[model samples]
Target: MNTAQLKQEIIEYSKKIGIDKIGFTTADPFIEMKNRLIRQQELQYQSGFEEKDIEKRVNPALLLDEPRSIIAIALAYPSKMTNRTISKKGERRGIFCRASWGIDYHHILRDRLHLLEEFIKEKVPHAKCKSMVDTGELVDRAVAERAGIGWSGKNCSIITPEFGSYVYLGEMITTIPFEPDTPMEDRCGTCNKCVDACPTGALVQGGQLDSNRCIAFLTQTKGFLPDEFREKLGNRIYGCDSCQTACPVNKGMDFHFHEEMEPDPEIVKPLLRSLLQISNREFKEKFGPLSGSWRGKKPIQRNAIIALTHFKDETAVDELIQVMNSDSRPVIRGTAAWALGKIGGEAANLALEKAQQVEKDEEVLNEIDKGLSFFCKDEVGQ
Candidate 1:
């Protein structure tokens, strides 16, 4: 079969295997993306999670010798969780962004790509292919954009017309020179909703992001969250979808095509207090399967403390005090101390004062001092 016939066969096979969208692009170097990446590095806007080597990130040739084509695939995830848990006065819950709703997408996308790789080999026995999900040297979004899977929305997501921006992207580089699909036109014309709605102004402008200020990146961090973004975090425990949720294109876009992609409402929107004292083993058992748990439990626990404080749930004072006084990680202890102050009451104040006497970490002690300062302000105001 000619390249056209092979491409057609691949497309048909993709649909059969539940690949929601598939497109192809020549594996030439991504010059534009390389330049943008350099600018992002210079501005200190890139999230540290990205592959450090800029050349390997943008040049498909570096990843696979004599690479002639890239096949991009996207799997749409559910926007709204069915059987959603409603947080009551005493049982407030923190949310994992829609991206983290189901099983870790990396596994799902990797499975799909594995199947595609097998299919490609069957068609062209001599075809050499290298597949990667989010963690690959090549940027998934850039490959998707080149393959015309979607337009690079101003929100920095590849927004497909069918799935909006809630799609998981993966790509495969192949020696076969399949016909490249046309890149989509920029459809976010004059719509600044995503940029304007960013809580931390992480969306510096269209198609550019300051990941340091991004709530999504911040929520995944293991250390003490910067004080400036604590209030901005709202009840988000892992990832932030504010920009995507604000996009008019993604409005009312909810697809539950894959059962594996369906979210367990309870896990995705777990009770804030219940998460505070969970053992590491318990956390891993409950959340390990989900994409949101990649950073382990500390960040989620810290965010839960902030969420409780955000609601000023005085009932959580006891739990926060326990975490502040006894948690092994300084970040957890420090954030709990900070949250206790935010949820200020006589009990909260007393806990902060007690923690200050024994806290060994200088950072934790500083946080304890910051927590006590809240009570001082309350007294002066009165």
Candidate 2:
């Protein structure tokens, strides 16, 4: 079986199966990535969600036996959501990043990888292939970059010239010795727009992201947002797109190729107040399909409360008071207290003062004090 001919056939099949871009690379250990990841670890820059075993992350041969080549695939998602919910004076909304706009890309990309695997097996009866999406041991972006699917963008995203960092990446390690594609040259040149535009300066130095400061990573933490970023949280309920939106290559780069990738305006940019009281079952049913919901509802709810404060949504003050009084999680309750303080009405201040008397958690107590301080700061100005 000629791998050159087989590679061409696989490329054809990929397009038919809705894969936007595909690339191939040798299954060598990612030495540069190892060094970079080690530096990130040393600096405590990792998001803590990554595989702790760095060896497993960098070596393809360890993950898959006799891995001759890696196949990287990218599917472009819509950058702009159509039928967006217009937030009025009283009805404000929080947004999920574009990556979580539709059904989880993991499911979508895995399905594509599965089909590709089946095709390769049919052609090479004894071919061994292992497929993986984001959760796998492999770093999907590194594989994609090496496979020529895209260059690693300044924002730490795999940025394809065709897809403009708006692509979901997946990869498969196969025993077939397919010829590798050349890596794309760094086209970003001197453009520091993405780094300059980061809200928390998460993109600390161009491509290097201090994940601790990344609003995207911060949005997914199931705890109180740091005092400094609480004001920077804005209306993002899940993930941050500040760097992506600021990219000059991503300018006017919205694509609605797949139906599953389309955003339901009501879901992605949902009403900030409505999220405050979402039940466990309701949260699952509504947002379960999106990739961003993997952290469950606590983080989203926590961010929603902060978002209310970002908008100073007086309408959410009553709900914030209720959460401060009754939410089961201390994080939610504490975040609600902080939101109330930022919203600062007589009712909000009174609710915080009342909750401080009964709240027991030390962290929650501190947040309650912070809420009361916001009121104190406001009075000083008045």
> Could you tell me the TM-score of candidate 1?
0.99
lDDT string for model 2 (1-382, tens) is 8999999999999999999999999999999999999999999999999999999898998988899999999999999877867987689999999999999999999999999999999999999999999999989989999999989999999998887999999999999999999999989999999999999988988889999999999999987789999889898999999999999999989899999999999999999888998999999999999999999999999998898888888887888898999998999999898888888999998999999889999999999999899989988999
Q: Name the 10 consecutive residues with the lowest summed lDDT in model 1.
A: 319-328
RMSD of 1: 0.9
Model 1 ranges with Cα > 4 A deviation: none
TM-scores of all models?
0.99, 0.99
Pairs with backbone N, CA or C atoms under 3 Å apart (clashes), candidate 1: none
lDDT by residue (145-177, candidate 1, tens digit) is: 999999999999999999999999999999999
lDDT of 2 at 100: 97
Clashing pairs in 2: none
